[model samples]
Target chain A: MSQENTAAKAAPGVEKKEKPERDIHNLGSSFIFKPNVIDDIHVKAELGRYRMRGFSLFKKIPHFDDLTFLPGTLTRFVIEGYREKCETKTILGPRAKRPMELDIPVYITGMSFGALSYEAKTALARGATMAGSATCSGEGGMIPDERRYSEKWFYQLIQSRYGFNPHHARLADAIEFFIGQGCKVGMGGHLMGQKVTDQVAEMRSLPAGIDQRSPARHPDWLGPDDLALKVEEVREATNWEIPIQLKLGAARVYDDVRMAAKCEPDCIYIDGMEGGTGAGPHLATEDTGVPGIAAIRQARKALDDVGKTGEISLIYAGGIRNGADLAKAIALGADAVAIGHAALIALNCNKDIEEADFPNEMGVEAGYCYHCHTGRCPVGVTTQDPQLRKRLNPDEAAERVYNFLHTLAVECQLFARACAKTNVHSLEPEDLAALTMEASSMAQVPMAGSQHTVGRPDMTRY
Target chain B: MAELESRDSHDMGMHDEQLAGRTQQIFFKPSAEENFTYPGAYEVDFDKETEFDAADMSNKDVNLKIRDLMSQGYGSITIRNPGAKHSLGVCILNRLQLTFDGSLGYFGCGLIDGPNVHIKGRVGWSCAENMMAGTVVIEKNAGSTFGAALRGGDLVCKGDVGSRSGIDMKGGTIIVGGKTGMNSGFMMQRGRMVILGDAGQNLGDSMYDGTIYIAGKYESLGVDAVESEMTQTDIDWLEKKLSIYGLKAPNGVENVRKIVSGKKLWNYDNLEPSEKKLIL
Candidate 1:
């Protein structure tokens, strides 16, 4: 009996008479309740809450890859890449005096001095200056090194007003009123006590060893109208010499852009849902905000609807990786684009670091690490510890960032040449076609191999 | 004083010119060759009769005009019939004395570094928001968000103030003589607020490090705000502030209640499980 049973059980295709009972205690894997879902349930059950901390959003949302450029073919002549000169120069905030002119259309987005190491911040400034672009002063305030290094800088006005000073405001080339970020639209900025080093505390005007939670909204202004007043105040403060920019997360893009335009800002910056942050609520980062493609399209439409098409500049950010993404963003009507996570990656973040180098309590490896909020970044991109931060030499990191930016511009020129555009800003929606219906609808472009656009009615068919 | 007399006659002549539809008035014109330098002062008098309209001129032009007058070495200026024009006196970086005879609109005297701004009438929202230093005195009621995000300054409001007053104030002294609207001193990091009148609800909500002195009744206190004993040092400071603003305390110093941050709401982990709902 044992030999026959064993032979039957061992057979590859045979079923034994007494089959192993399904493990009822461990419920079978369910598509509806995935592993992460189950794990989240357990976490909530143990913690008695759903507090989004440390991790970013995990859900995959719509992105720019859904669309493809319709390069010039037989009907149109594609410019020769090596022989032709494709312009990448960009001008921002032309409506105001002292508009920022850059040699390239790509810029370094804001990363606060507190959130990133001093070396990382300096590296970004140096790299941006070398690349003939601008770097932004993120949340806390403008550091001396960054201000001295960056030729052109955009100072961010976060809700918390941490380290905000009028003297610094006057020194900036432009001021950006940070309404929200892509990763956490409705949430405030969070800096754990561990990251609040003495320098960070001084910069933010807070006591050391205290956690900081920036307010979600501006303290004085509540809505768009109030924002208009605040903008006027800032304009008066600057003597109308510098441009003013309004930045927002990509949610309700059309309405927000319209409101922001009415406020008469020189530029509007929209960050898509795929944006990264030092720390954010997991659910907010994942579940909230629209993608870059949709945001750019809607922002353009809003500007057009408000009769502010060329009167105000539009800047796009979030998940912009390379030259192709830059070209696509410009084609979708963004005057310029900003880089964050990609720039960090170029600076050697989450790379070339051994697991042993990481703090033992972190329990993470190089490629899968995201402990920026803990102030224990092994690669030193987001740490405050002197020893850890020393690992990233600003000179070397600046060279890498400069190379990355240079390569991105070169790649963008190639795309622009193939699209038969002399200037990157001249690239239009007509040069693009959507590969999927969702993208076609959002982008208002015709589907590939189809005569009809998704959102608009086809008069030819009618 | 003789210059003042000459200026008075010039102002009258400008008023007649204004009636003749020649409304543009350049009090102290700067030559193109002149190089403007700081640490100077101004004493130009802007009046409605002269048609020196803050509303019609660009902020740049007004600021430039102010700068020019200051560069000419005038130390004090008086404005009459302000009529609530927005941004009347902004970005003045000198140590001048600006006196407004009438009500001003939004952002009046905003971002002044060293100027002593005196508003005789009510002010619009954000009277001195994000102001760095110097003194801002409002004789009447103030709109919402009065003295918001003030880093280092002295703001004295003689009458009632609207909601969210002293919000996000980093380092400053705010003295309110009358009733205050809701959410006063919210998220204040390091500052001193002296309220001699009744205070609205949610006083000192989420404040990090600050001292609030209230002599009158308060509606409610926000999370992490609690009353503490009023020490003698607080009374002396209050007295000094009252004297600076030329105000009498509404009640005895013994009646003033001192409020400070409880330090319990600084971290989320410090909150009790039941208190988590308050944050959410």
Candidate 2:
């Protein structure tokens, strides 16, 4: 038999059908071949041709969902929900002369006045006061209204030196030296000309309708030793009455935490990958910094390595949503948790607008809004426009924030009760378990239903 | 140092003991004078004057003592034999006058709100940094980042200043008697910098709304820093600032080169890519 005839005869009843070429338009793999629509729109279309505007890039990344709490069942005893009392109060910077004592472990992270409306800032302060927590004055100068409403306030000494006044520094309960933020780790803050109103310009001492770009690093100091001296300067400036906190983004978390601890700050504040910003470069927000879970683990380890675990307080920010997240952070060794995007949400950020004009008035649907940098927010929480800002009444918005904080505290207490912990701080890494191997390795905790830890060898002993 | 010891203990009766006791027990305030001497207090006598040294104590202790004295409203402190100590006379709230008789270290008189600090010798980095509504006079040379991030005050460096002098200055007058190192008045938003001697390269780099008056030879200027005609108003302002520090202009007003913000780099909307590079 001929070779071709023999081959065809060997595979009896097999059809010789030719396969068509694969389509390039719809590649099955989303990550490798296809271009991300969001990234293309922002990088290629918007910022590619013009100056960068203020808008945070939203992307899906690994977060707190990978971890889960191992509730008490047979080996551990869970407290009765009805009769037991779980403490939610937390103290920060206990080594300092005047440590910040909070009724609840949750605090409002720094969000500047240039970024948010005056009403929104006041509302945050009032809400934090009602919750017996603290609110921070962000990059911009401290507003009088916010100070009037807030019981305890943290003042940020950012690199820009915008609206930085000695009077405000002295007035703050604690001073936070803002080294970097999570949204844009190595980059500085940007406020577009549209957002620079007369009030904003006056506060920052900049020209009206001018784009303000803050320096990425401080002009005064460079290295960790220099930072230590600067910390001394701030301590002296506040008469050593208020605690000094070093705020850093979660990039090189272990090294950054170590350096910040060496500066002898009373507290170290770490902002992770999921932290929100008023505005930032699209590339920076999407592809920079470590996640909050991983950051907390490294920060705790760094503090422990330096033998300053409890000596210096650790405040964690980024993607902290509710009481469960707060409980998880505390368990990972955070003295307190700060909320930014969630606080704005509590102030009606993405809520449905019931006005008659509705979508037409804002030029966008309520639920799909993320135009905080435009200075024309429909919800009035992020806008500086007088008309838009009027929509957010400080008193009413404050009540919502209060309710949100109350709910978080209650939820945290419930979690503590489940773990049979008397205080929220008593929840340790042993009480947590990871749902995935990635999370188990990063958090150094045992995988679900397994006695072996993913990264550490002797975590079972913990 | 011996003059400080000869002062009568009875003369140190300015602060009431009860008020001092109450203030000391409060947050961040120094406790009652049990072991050490309160430098600013007139009635309080030191247990061992020779042993008390600001260099030996922490910046917290030094500042707390200064603040305690300032809290009494108004007073004078004579820090004798101060050897380059950081954060001397920092955050003095009231109109207390601090006289440093020797060299000081980094952040000396930093964030001075209302105090008048006189340093008789040279200072280390960031002397009078972020000073607000106060007067800081460095009798000799100042280290790098001198008067950095100054908000509202007068900082007079009688001698040369290091690099990045008067950086990010807002609403203040910084007078440098001798030469200034690189990037003087860099990113200065508002204020006036008067340089009596020569300037290093990148002078007034990226200055937004400040004025720079150089009476000596000028090196290369930074982007957005332009030489404008010196006006009578500029001369008058310079004279006023110099008079406060008991200084005289090294050169005539005609010889002075007045540098101001070009206002071209204020907004990036109209600027070309090349122009942006020039300012950035």
Candidate 3:
């Protein structure tokens, strides 16, 4: 080839690299980051982007109307901080004399070593410690520094067990046997072999480039009875000194909770349909599992039915944000809550920043970028790039985590006070009245405490 | 008694010695914290460094019934021939500590868990299933599905593994010095599986994902799975793991292939050839 021709071939976007071209299902990276892209199809309209569509027979209409909160009655007076005083000090895990102790309800969820950077895992532990709560290390065993943070750690033992140090066998404060995650139930986790570093490969104990796969059901367990037996095995190992926890995706909440209660674990954690992941097939995320609300309500009722109401604490996750959400969750019978995406928000992940070496035009911004499917987290929160990881200081990030938790607690406290409830658990459905029929009925709150009005509160207590 | 006395002073005194009680009183007590008891009426103290004298001790549920009586917070425990005359049948299910130096070793095994579990003989498959911690060393080969769904622990085999070794393995390390039959690392999610010898064909076939590393010649790689490029990160990782397994830096290891499943497909269809190449 001539020099001129070679120069043309080497030009930026033009290269000889042959990308496997296909017209197969293009779930591609398109929907991975953007929300509701499934509904945004481009179609011809009479009046395009400018004017109202001229020939359109149907127009977009608001789905609901006039939602309002119930006003306080004379018997139930609102306290200070109509701007401030509600309390949200909810406890997760049965503190009912269980051998294990977890100080905060809001804890970090599980993220595997292969899925995240070692730096990210360490940072999560640091942040959880800073926040005065626990961060979970995934099945990849205990990295040395991770073990150092064991005081504030919840070790999630996945199917592919790694980081298991015999000397540190008794270290974990709690044990969580990951069943089905909200993202994908019954499907195995896959870390693209290309991404598997030798360390990652070694940690997983596989041939260098071969894909790693976990079985759908536990090898020894076939059903709930088997699961309980396994739970007993763990209990025996720890001498019943640490609380055992079971984490499951919200697929069949009633059945799942029922089975979990049989094992008598200290807590049952539920992650809903919208659970986030570093990477997962699009079909699994969008098409699988029930939503968080249905799962939580069904599970709570299941617990009550089985006479295990206070036996196992219930924690709900999947797309939670702010004080109101926390209150709604508690009102729905959740003992506490877990935060994944919201935690990322607190850490300011996916930020919009201008840099010389930008990869794409659609700049990443906090809360909007779900580009974690690729290992390139531009904002340094999710990527494995050493330089980027250095940008985040665990100590500082951990402080932010602490601050966020502290602030959320204050807000919860304020709400509890407003409803005349001294404790968070005391602020019940009786104190809550939703503005929308959807929320009121879904939350099972007795609207108006009377009839016919979703937002109206019964003033008889007045 | 007079005839016994004429044989020898020692022999005459043997009956007297028996009357004198050579063995210490082995009292069995209930665990102060629990409602359970040792159940069986036999006890052996290793401090006498006594070789285990029991011929059929393996079939009993030891961890659930007798483990507490042996606790002294010591570093090592060796049980000789516990299963020599009996089928262990879930007796030592979760009681081996082969990895931790201060562990309880059951000499003969049908099933075991935790502590440096050195099996001087063969172990039944599922020997280390769902083991949360410890080491299981099998001097002989294991049956099918060994270390299946193993969460945390180490399983080191001195001999070949039967079919489906490390199947659906989530987390933990399984090192087989000899060759592994078919279905090794099948449906592996997370964790490293090091196979020193040649692997049977379709090593990770139908596998949705996870990593697999083989150091021998491959008759055939899995479907939708292709060779991945070995980056510097991969090199460093290989070196570290090699050092861990007491092997050299893997700088000149022969036929070291990195087989990878691509990012696209949920199972096998999307596995594309990787860009990096393994020199060895």
Candidate 4:
């Protein structure tokens, strides 16, 4: 989160410019009390409740952009950029009998059907299939088409158990136990009444048009010990075939992950504070969990400590925008990455399409809109309205999602090959160097021009 | 590495029945037709009865044996000395008459769609969790979270059940002949829970849309749960449901207390501006 700094110097032939005259009447403004902050207080005072929105955290954090790849130079031999093979094929939950194999290391994360339109959900399913990746039936249960279109599918057993069906679960390639989400660490999911149509209501077995507030705790099991027994139940149900993954929000990463490992899940998914939500409290989104850079490091260390590194796979999600982010995650210790907001962007989430009147309909310009909670998405990706939904063509959207996923995989390969790693999974922490001290400390990687990592004792001992 | 068995919608029977309009996914194209042909679902005969002992077998072996028997058309099956095995008799989707002479550990009879199951002994936590359409009956005391997230069919426990029983129950009839522990019917959405004996604290807490009928006194009510006037319809349902399991309320069905959601928490921001501002 370092701000850009530049110093001004006058040319030899030009005269130096004078500083602008300060207004004597002005006592000057408080940098701490910025206009946006003041406006937020005012809005809250009026609303009498916390503001809710659909997007990733607005505040900046130490992120993938702060970490730069130090690819092969003189010491190591580089693989050919495009010609040589850089294996993007990834496997998660290797210990499971039927491990989830992906052609690419990235897959679309779960976003519930009630929070999104049918077209958007199916399009993602079809797209992920085409990309040889996977799609998760997020919360409100499995839509038939989403299941039919997806080659590899994850059935999420969220706390709410909304529309959670064993028939649908039995059809899954894997099961995701939604213990928590990154966007709202300890909170449950929220789908505004606007989007809770009759179809969604029936699926979740709730009254339609009622604001759906999912429970944070699972109805059956309460703790990790019970979770172990619950895992056994699912394993027995699935005939011990598909993998069972526990998706945990990034909080007390080391301890939480250690406990999760004890539960004996095939995979552990860590969702960072930077993760986007279809709808969530703005405060929770900005302030809840640790950032991805830090979360992955702790999670990996926890797995290593537990002697389950190879047996239990780690999948990281939150604030991943492009290939470099995906590659950086793997280097930091993630076996794979999951993308939600980025995939939505690829599905024309904020695009200024022909049918979209963004400013008029959403009260913002195309790129500025984050109104998925409103169920009035101008681009049709997050809406249930038939007219708005028609704005998105599932066929084209599916292709775009495929293209986006493909580009990310290829881009991730570019970094891997440059780093002289034939396999994308071979991109290790040694290939990365942090541009900022926060990144250096959090990611536990060295600074850009130095061998010194901020938090490592050896660097300070000297 | 091994072949996966197919689990169909209750029956391998609903051929060509569209996933009903319940999904509200009307934009489905003819090309991407919903395929209901779950290839590996079994067709069994009820008259073909068999019994086995699962005293020494692992959960995987026991479940596999049951499925194998079903595949071979042995529909009415019994397992003796189940030995309090966890996850026993799970995810049985076919219409079979299954019985267990002994007790089951946690998650017994869970995720089942169509089965008439009887457990002669007690059951542990989360028994019959997410059962779609089935009759799961326990003769003795049941543990916590009994029938959690139950979707349909009849689930009965003649003896007392622990806390959070029927938590998040969707559509089903849970008739507990004995007392129930705290938070019974917590967050219940759609269903009828009939607790004939004394109900514990926080009865029918935070329910969305459901009815709870308790013949005895409830220690306390949880948030948004309130008592309502019992009608003839409630009496009829209680009487009919109780009779099926040969359960009679100590007090008459008409004297049973009814609890339902107050609809206050249903739409949190239904107060002022956008209802979307749920802080979760």
Query: Whose lDDT is greatest here?
Result: 4
Worst 10 residues of 3 chain B by lDDT: B20-29
Candidate 3: regions farther than 4 A off: A1-71, A77-92, A95-100, A162-169, A193-195, A206-216, A353-367, A434-441, A446-462, B1-125, B130-145, B149-165, B168-185, B188-280
**Candidate 4, clashing residue pairs?**
B151-B171
A1-462, model 3: which lDDT tens digit per residue? 799887556667665677689869775675354544433323213212111100001211111121123435587776665554344444545543444444555677777766666555655665666555677777656654544543456777565554443234456677777787776666656555444556666665555554345445555445676567556555555545667888888887898898889877888888777566665655566667766655677788888888887768888876566666665566567787777766665654654544312336225334356665444665556555555555554545555666776666666656666666656666555665545555555454544545443333552221
Off by more than 4 A, model 4? A1-25, A460-462, B1-33, B272-280
* lDDT sort, best first: 4, 1, 2, 3
Worst 10 residues of 4 chain B by lDDT: B1-10
Compared with the true structure, the alpha-carbon lDDT of candidate 2 equals 0.79
Per model, how much of the real contact set is kept? 0.39, 0.40, 0.09, 0.54
Better of 1 and 4 by DockQ: 4
What lDDT tens digits, residue by residue, belong to model 4 across residues B1-280? 0000132222222233232112223332333335645423578899999999998898779999999999999989999999989999999988999999999999999989899999999999999999999799999989999999999999999999999999999999898989999999999999989998988898988899899999999999988888999988888878888888999999788899999988878877655454333222
lDDT tens readout by residue for model 1, B143-194? 9888888888799999999899999988888889898889999998888988
What lDDT is reached at residue A312 by model 1? 94
Best by DockQ: 4
Model 2, B236: alpha-carbon shift in Å? 2.9
Per residue, candidate 2 scores C-alpha lDDT tens digits across A267-356 of: 999999888887766667888998888899899999999999889999999988888898898888888899999999899887885631
The total of clashing pairs for model 1 equals 2
DockQ comparisons of all candidates to the true complex: 0.19, 0.20, 0.06, 0.34
Report the C-alpha displacement of residue B26, candidate 2, in angstroms: 20
